[model samples]
Target chain A: MSKALLQNEVIILDELDRQIIQATQSGLPLVPRPYHHVAEDLGVTVKEVIRRMKAMKDTGIIRRIAAVPNHYALGYKGNGMTVWDVPSELVNDLGHKVGVLDFVSHCYHRPRFLPDWPYNLFAMVHAHNRKEALLLVDTIAELLGKHDRGHDVLFSKQILKKTGMRLL
Target chain B: MDDLDRKIINLLQEGFPLTEEPYADVAKQLGIDESGLLSRLKSLLDEKILSRFGPMYDAAKLGGDFSLVAIKVPKDRFDEVAGIVNSYEEVAHNYHRDHDFNMWYVLATESPEKIHEVNADIEKRIGLKVFNMPKLDEYYIGLKLTA
Candidate 1:
């Protein structure tokens, strides 16, 4: 594990925390008092459920308790997995700038298999169509400027399987 | 979707307020009644526009490990190899892409060490090298799609 992740492992969740996560991992029921339902199911008070969820969010365990929109269903037909060949020394700064763009959803610095795969920076961009997605890619290219050595957009052909965020 | 539905989606994608009356707060902001907001959200979910409506947890932070693995599956054996790879419950998403390393999947396990074990099992069964690419650094991971 990386030093950063190892350090984060220190914050362990208790049994109650695990129970809460297990109960709500799929999703929170869309009721007037969703937490109340979860609390009752887990044999806890509504206040306790909210407190634990808030704590989890504060600790970065929960990014956000929000609605995850389906880009494709929302008329975003063109989805591009754009990869860039960026210099290792400048990836951190360049990645930050690329990530801040509204169109780019996910940005990460991954290892490259030299000779075979030269791209190290991955950013996913979504748009109404292929043209729009490429335009977004061009915008990213403009942002990278001198740091971007090369880039390519790999549009997914099909989804063989998509079971969103399942962990038991 | 109508303008009102789009507006609700745009707002909710950012986040839902954490309070006793969270729906009321969001409804007030959107200029709609609390019941209307709830029913709209329900309909969006029912229509399959929103995959889910709840807290988005960080798997890694919750003591789970996630890795992106790619494989070069020959056209003839692609289906067979995919079955072998997808059989494992740890595989969350398997996507067919247009590239030499055409098959890509995300694997989630309880621990970091299990990532290697699962990869080994996959490679052994498929008779192909699995390029396990775990994110060295995550710059950002939020996708907000405005309708």
Candidate 2:
């Protein structure tokens, strides 16, 4: 009956850290020495910039410095938010199982609003088309087996906005 | 995308090196020159193949709060409600989906209290109940999509 949310140790960001975030939140400068460019812009040394970034990364403030591909552009057009109304007792375990699937991008145990919404387990499935996405959902359903009370897939009709989290 | 582009995407997704000459270091590993690697990355981003190329920050870890919220908008009033919801700076990644709870978006704020405040404000403005479904448990995240 543990409904504890996964909490990471929050890190207090300093002024320079905030500045770094602002500078790089949109993107890192596409240059040979991108960190050095940021340092120059912020009136700090390259070493200082790298040190602060490393610290932030180590503390989990920055998940990772990497490239995020556009799924649609990559031909993953069938994006389905598959939600399941699984037994509360088995949600966490089932979520882990679904999450490890190659096609499942995100899996989480969320609060269920009964009467209207019964889904507590949410998994995002990506595929090349609707048929493929549904097939992937079947894979999750098979994996869940008897625990899969019921589920529904919500395909995105339109992307109104997708700016991600911008620290303002 | 060619072999080199695929290679860059796969390798970069793993992580970009944090160093004085990070791109150079990566280039050496890819057996390409520093300038060549940079150009390929630039082209990938410009061509919209790569949505983003930077540090993905964990807002919660950085002392911020975020939640997934949905509002069942009337079909006729969808655009109006969407405009109102999207007007808020806190609202990120809004989508129209195929369901009764059609309008779903994520609210990321600098404080946990702000999450509630924003949700309440949106409900009041739109005259619809905003269903806030925050994660009680994150079983897993970060699926590396192969190029």
Candidate 3:
């Protein structure tokens, strides 16, 4: 973990910052002066809006200011939440390896619910179809080798709700 | 998406400049005028090709608690349970997966205690156990899916 992430100190946001998030959370305006639009909406100067956003970005709250493509629309129709039942001691190492794979988007070490759920590691893989998804899973299995304890891929039946995040 | 559209998606994912004239800066790199790039982006978003086009915030870093909770809603009650679960403002993303633990959703709350509170309230309402799986460690997160 990076030092900044490990601090465990909760960075408090002032009212202005909250307003900025509320204004831009849905999306940034697609104008020539996008920040200017946000500034105008929040009743702040363009420079202040830019300054606060930059500060938030530096602190890691803003992971990145970028375009998040819909994997499905990009021809990656298949999506799988692949979970692994590797030894707890080896999970961190295995997770880092799986995470770096080009096809894997998000990977994390989460707690396991015994008996019902033995998987402790989760990685989301995307592909054009189920066949391709399985092939990518095979690559992960190959990398894991013996350390690959039993694992299962849960394909999403439907997206019940997918609002990224709402700070209401 | 055309060749230019694909190029824009690929380039923008890397990161957008936070400059005064950020769009113009990016347009220069893509060899397109600022207006053209803006129109393409608008169309992409209008078509839902790009789910979002802005800063992706980390709730934890912003002093909020989050967790991935799963529940085994009886097949008959799937939609009913989903409705009750989605009613909460804290439930950010919910999905129906092909597993015994069928319903999975993310809960984001302003305080750590709220994670449990919300889970307990949902369990009480739905009469189903909620398996709260908060991240023990984050190995990696961001990835650029090539267009």
Candidate 4:
């Protein structure tokens, strides 16, 4: 896993990799030496665990190893999915600019349905309240400028279900 | 969250070190003892301030396809439709948003083609169009909320 070539290339997950992910999927234990705990449990070594994690990160398989704060608990009670109907020709350049905004969290260029749906750009925004979220949407609106044909913010009313991915 | 907890959240979001003793490394950087740092993290989790703390995997890179699907479910049948949608293992999360296209959910499938199959299946069963909006380009995909 420490090999530079392996780090730079995308590698498929072997049995060992899958086992390690399953073991730590929920989370690494809250201990002083977390990797050592995982290694000991898996009968490998601390170095192996760290190396594999590094490889995963480098290859973009693992986005990051960090804390995911609860936005609601952290005072970001308002959450809205701001969708834009930008011309397909200018979406690539416009998407890049919208994605870099401090308030936009997850930005992507998605497809639009015909007749009724026309938005192709989606950006999830968060703020302390709906007002603030709308204001953030305003900032994005200003950024989009003339390129933005139309837009709407869909505020989340209820979370029907919330769970992380489960490897099947 | 108090001052120290705020500091911990802010710093941890930036990233945790990947050293021999990562927690100890973080503790030293935060001017706290290893045990104290561990205890604080445990409390944060117990209190649900931090929903999760671990590696965030990219499903697409892991040989899976993810999509944001929306349905314009009728208001009278929303609950029934939600139940039907949530019953599938492919559905990662479902949310009810205030809009004409109200029901939105994320689908994670073993293969890219499975996404369309699942969408068609759901459409046939629920009698509504499943708008499959797979990401064409991902510009950014991280959220860092300052505590």
Candidate 5:
């Protein structure tokens, strides 16, 4: 899905765009015509609802309107936080590359503290169990040449939260 | 009003009704009018204070899988790579976090098998090695944003 467009990207979020984004992302009403329900509640026409959303899409704000699965209930045993010591020059390039993979869920770049923490890149890997999680982590480290540089793997001791962006 | 907003958020986060008029019902529960509820909700959404108020499905329950992945993208070429990966139907959300591996995104599909297929396809299409790390365990998964 699309994310917040850069200001230089010629994006403008008007009132209607904000309204529809607020309506849809605030969780879909579990009805048949979700948009209709949202439009009615928001005191706007359904056509306007869709139109504004489309506008947001062109401007680059609203990402996706899909069901976010509950991984915990699926017997996924762990959430591992893995980091990679990728070259500073290619951190964004590599991060974007890794993000396209389905196995890697949430990836970000954190400041690198050398001598103490050598890993320059960070990624969150979710699996059914530790073995599978480690398999992915170790494979990533190997491919990224962790031994040659230096990296760290800190298992997600806790998930502070997991909520996507909203219009507000 | 903020207290009421917080309460509504707490209730909806737990689960939204699948009714024809869910907000009306949510308003009824809050002892407020539907229009009033909508107005307040409008303010909350406009502020970017609330992340989302939608269905949280069980992907594996519905025969699907997903994972969070990240890669170190070149600064100058972020928009380029993000455009490529975000183009994929399987990709959900992409972000440029402030760090080394700045570009991160999530993917979900109908099956674990598809997870591999999509990622592999992305690797070939992007010509980059994807570090696939699935979740091993979960300690906590929540954020008190309204507060």
Candidate 6:
């Protein structure tokens, strides 16, 4: 486990937590007082279900629970995974800038394997089309003055499956 | 959910009980009748919004390969390739990306040959190389939003 996890002492998840995570991930039913239904199914009280979910967030097991919306279903078509060869010294700064961009939904700084894959900073841009998506990436690169850096633009060819995590 | 929908998703997620009167069992707990709950569930699934309300076979348990693939479709022919690529039932969620290898998509297939065949076909049809990136390791936040 990462030192961060050890230091935080995240309680190792138990059966109840695992089942509860599975129940929520599958999709909450659309009805009045959903928690009541969830609680009954798990052989627990509605209040208990709420309490456990709350504890998950409190203890950092869960970040947040909200609708996992599908961007494609909403008709915003252009989505791209982009990589940038940010210098090791500037990776942290560039990663922050990339993360703050509205179109860049996800960003990370991965190790830059030299000679083969030199690009370390990765950013994802979602937009309406190639022109708009590329425009966002280009602008970010320009602002960072790393436009000359080696990068790859990976546009999605197809989506084989879209699923949430299974707690089992 | 206000009340009932929550019960249904919870039941499905927990792995639907095998007994014939599973609905009744669930209803007894929720203080409702089985028939009404079943009917409501049928509607939610029909909406296509609930992609699935069923158990997913464990991929690792079955020894399956799960990977995300990306390719660059020429700007002029994005629509054409998308149509051909999406035709395969294997392609689930696809989008046009902005990078040089413009097209990206996820592929989940059991055997390596099946995956390789997909690339071969896409290349033969579109005349572009697919950057097949197998997941060396996964660092996930579990990325599921629990509401």
For candidate 2, the clash count comes to 0
> What TM-score, over all chains together, does every model reach?
0.96, 0.93, 0.93, 0.95, 0.50, 0.57
Q: Between candidates 4 and 6, name the one with more favorable lDDT.
A: 4
Predictions in order: lDDT? 0.88, 0.89, 0.89, 0.87, 0.58, 0.59
lDDT of 5 at A83: 72
Clashes of each: 1, 0, 0, 0, 48, 29
| DockQ agreement of candidate 6 with the native complex | 0.10
Which tens-of-lDDT digit does each residue in A27-132 have in candidate 5?
7654445768778888987777766655544443433333233445334555666777777777766776666555676666655544445666666777887788
DockQ of each: 0.75, 0.67, 0.71, 0.63, 0.05, 0.10
TM score of chain A per candidate: 0.95, 0.90, 0.90, 0.91, 0.81, 0.85
lDDT of 3 by residue, B19-131 (tens): 88899999999999999999999999999889889988877776677899999989999999999999998998999999999999999898778999999999999999999
TM-score of 4: 0.95
Output the number of the DockQ-best candidate: 1
Residue range B36-127, candidate 5, lDDT tens digits: 87777666655545544453323433234666666666778766776787877777665555455565667776656777887788777776
Model 5 score (lDDT): 0.58
Tens-digit lDDT string for candidate 6 (A1-168) = 222343566365667766776676676554545667777788987767777766766665554443222445334467777888867777777677767766676676655445545666667777777778888878877867943377777776555334444434
lDDT of 1 by residue, B51-95 (tens): 988888888877778999989899999999988888998898999
Candidate 1 has an lDDT of 0.88
Question: Candidate 3, A7: how far from true, in Å?
Answer: 5.6
Best-matching candidate per TM-score: 1
Superposed on the true interface residues, model 3 gives a C-alpha RMSD in angstroms of 2.0
Model 6 chain B worst lDDT window (10 residues): B138-147
| Comparing 2 and 6 on lDDT, the stronger one | 2
